[model samples]
Target: MPVLEVRRHTMRSKPGQHLSQQGVTLASLIGNSTGPFDLVWTSEKPRAIETAIAMGYTLTRQSAALGNLPKSILDAVAWPNDLESISKIVRRNNACERFARAQAEEWRSIAGELKDNQSALIVTHGAIIELGAIGFMPNATYSTWGDAIGYCEGFRFSQVEGLETCELLRVPSHLQLIHN
Candidate 1:
């Protein structure tokens, strides 16, 4: 997720927020990559839907299953801010492990189904990129969970024998921070 557009939401949770300037920059940046996606999946959230549209994809399905990780457990427990701790394990489980498993399964099925040169794009949350990509590649690591992929950046994957491989991909510069 981009800095301004980054956050998590569950089904029926609405932020009532519109696109930020950073988000529009991302859309134009990501859109430049000609995506002839055969199918585009997105969360029902406006950010995800809009991100997909901004990137020039037509949404084929919007699913809650592909949305952000449920934050109920994290909300229930009062935890320290330190990420490198025993408490992080519990947070990681709730926010990452299980959701990653589910997403990896879905990714595997899609990877298996696609033909040569065919592609599917999933516009989803940061957790879906971090935990999910790491789930598929157990050795992957990052300075923090959220840092696994930046806002508007993600992993491209290919699966074989029920395992998927990931390659990090980022949105190109839209020149908002650059002087002309």
Candidate 2:
């Protein structure tokens, strides 16, 4: 039982808000993820929207950066780069890196405003999760989707320096794999 859980929709042939067979798997995963969440944020892509719907969550808001992304780029990447892949792919021109940072910032800002009674669900890409996690584990970097999927990934942020805290839980056991 995690306080927060972020999942990448199983597999997508494209990058929009469309649902696949994975939706059922995702729904099951959400059911296992927890009883209910106070808020849910998702990217504006078809796949993401579909995933949110399948999971029985209402898509109240969308990340601008996510909506601006071109699906062609997402489809081209294999996801989860190893050392070799990192060597070949890491660069200043990496839009994914840029997007990831922006996404993380948004989530951080949103998390900061949370009240004690509120719990949130943020539906985003693997890269964003990696960027957010960077602050937690200085040495451990999320390099691929597989790494994200295998781990129940998320973060906890404390406001008032040490008093109030918001968490993002990534518990594998709580996730149910679904392909709509």
Query: Which parts of model 2 have CA positions greater than 4 angstroms off?
Result: 1-5, 13-17, 67-78, 82-100, 135-146, 150-180
- In the range 119-171, model 2's lDDT, one tens digit per residue, is 56666665445444442222333343223332223454444544434344444
Local distance difference test, per candidate? 0.54, 0.50
What tens digits encode model 1's per-residue C-alpha lDDT throughout 1-180?
A: 101111222112235545565675556566566466787777777877877777776887787766756675334222222223313453455554565567667655555556665777777765454544545555544334333355566767665555544556654455435101
Alpha carbon deviation, residue 71, candidate 2 (Å)? 9.8
In model 2, the Cα lDDT at residue 16 comes to: 44
The predictions' CA RMSDs to the true structure, in order, are: 6.9, 5.7
